[model samples]
Target chain A: MPIRNTDHAWGSINKAFHWILALLIIGMGFLGWYMTWLPNAPGKIKIYALHKSIGLTILALVLLRILWRQFDRRPSELPMPHWQAVAARGVHIALYGVMLLMPLSGWLFNSAGNFPLQWFGLFHVPSLTDGENPALKAIAGITHLILFWVLLVAFVLHAGGALKHHFIDRDSTLRRMLPWGTRAEKSSPPPAMTATHSTPNSSSPTEVKS
Target chain B: MKTVLLFVLASGFCASAGARDWSTDAAASKLGFSGTYQNEKFEGQFKKFDAVISFDAADLSKAKFDVTVDVASVNTANEERDGSLKDKEFFDFAKFPKAHFVTSAFRKAADGSIEADGTLTVRDKSKPVTLKVKFSEAGDKATLDADTKLNRLDFDVGSGDWKDTSIIGADVLVHAHLSLTAKAG
Candidate 1:
């Protein structure tokens, strides 16, 4: 429940950011698809506005999460193979990249369409263009969609890896990221540091950012 | 002799107040509207509209403006938005194809500009509006620029779910600029 993350577990702030962003992003996925099925009408406009507002909310949360990461401590990676560790890092980096790019592209798409942008009806967001830009609109629209798929795949791998660690490997990686999840005692880590899943030297437990 | 001279002078002054009829030079005129959508202001125009102007600078109180705008001809540069604009919750082009603005009274403003009080009818809803007008004349040619603001909700322009004005603003600004040529007397 600490404000700042410790060397072995996520802090309250990071956990909130993670879960809140997760729910919102998932909600956006549903909203994005649901709105497409709607007939073009005044109601559709309102739905699109709602989608934009939530997307903007996700964007802000992603930014705060990244900023907090810079000043927070990273729980050391659970003993795992060099290859699996490297793959995990790659997935995390990809997720972070899209975390920023996804909302930004959505914003560009809205702006290029010359649609008004507002954040939960609280304030206005400026447009990327002065008027409708067909070329930019097409490009941004495609990028926004592609990023959605990219994020889906990357998060799948990321979550799958965490589950693998928590279940098959019986490691504490997944728990550390959960809101109320706790880290295992460092003294008796599950027989994880063997010759199979990881190289011997890689288990030296150097602190790493996830 | 003095009374006869005074009467002749008064009659000449009254005759000068007679108005000249003018028609719009559509090529050089524009009838547009703007509104704040979620705090971002956007503008749109009526592509097909006409105005009949009758006026005399000597007596603006006698001036009149009659304008009719094709609601279906609205173009906001975004087709999707324009489509929404023509729906029943907005302009309802199917039911009311044209919107009208006609002046009933005119008065001079404190700033020396003229104010035209008119009734604007849109989507079968009518509301009294005042257009702050600036007019100028050169020879037989004249130009008129006027603008007014109204609450869109008052006319049921944003009905249904769009009735929530927190996202889209309620106030809409309508404007017109016209170049007119006097008819040959």
Candidate 2:
């Protein structure tokens, strides 16, 4: 099916952002679980440092995606059963909301717990809380755990939906977001590839708006 | 006759002389104690703390001892509270890691308890304080119990004002029990 100008599929750049961020979030979730059983022994410091690094990166990339989404138009929605469309819309919005809240709550949790956040030994991210209050600390701890579960569930639903589209629907819905797929399927390629592939004759003047 | 009188007096003085009061045994003796600090709505014990105490009963006239406690070893179980105590605004473990107390004077009290006056140094602040100490001797071992109250504001522990006292108490109590054995001759 041809990509529509409106109510259409994701363009290459948008698809790239979604896939890359999804991959990073998945890696982060697994890393978080693995770090918990680290025995608080040798190399624990390094593990924690690595976790903080990834957490900060997720914060940055997620923020960047949000800004990009605001400026660039989203691909048109797929035509489907009314209920399926509603479910899809609700889940996508919830996915974005929880995605934003998870990292933010994680930051507050670490800050309140008084863990110095250093980005790869560069510098410390100053603490957000002052003197310790058991009640406040407990609340922050609970919030952190809840957000983690929410993020996990949202991710599974998001991935399962994508996979369902790929296998059951046999449509370009999943292919459109795969990193290796065609321009309409994948997001914009890396700057290096685009620069290398650029040629005066290959330019589609109308496609330059992106 | 005069020589005999001198000998008699010397023997009497020697008879009344007491044994040495303090020992320098680095091992087999330990000082254990508990200290509590409160912040706004959080209060916890400083668990698993040991101090070095050396003193003797016979040398009460000129007794002296030094005490040192590990700051990092404090355990409140709550990570946030423990972490705050380690920060620069509090214990400042990076700069002044260990708190110390050194005895400077001891005076016999009419009530039989001894008033051991000393300087307690915590986080670079040294404050003169007196500990009420009771001692019990048994064979080759001696037990000492001391209790003291400290005003943290005097040491700039918290802010100068008591406004923060709602969370962190203004006064901290330090209690110690030291059991020591006589060193071998």
* Model 2 Cα lDDT, one tens digit per residue, A67-157: 8777665543333345655566666776677667766776667666655566766766655677344566677768767878877776677
RMSD of each: 4.7, 15.6
> Chain B in candidate 2 has what TM-score?
0.73
* Candidate 2 DockQ vs. native: 0.06
Chain A only, candidate 1, TM-score? 0.87
**Model 1 root mean square deviation, Cα atoms:** 4.7
**For model 2, what TM-score does chain A reach?**
0.77
lDDT of 1 by residue, B1-185 (tens): 99999999987776665577898998899998898766678898898998889988778767888988888989887757887888887888889899898999999888888899999998878999999998888989999899899898888887887877765689889888999999887
Provide i-RMS per model in Å. 2.4, 12.8
Would you estimate the TM-scores of all the predictions? 0.80, 0.51
Docking model 1 quality class = acceptable
Any idea how many clashes model 1 has? 1
- Classify candidate 2 by CAPRI docking class: incorrect
In terms of TM-score, how similar is model 1 to the real structure? 0.80
For candidate 1 chain A, the 10 contiguous residues with the lowest summed lDDT are A200-209
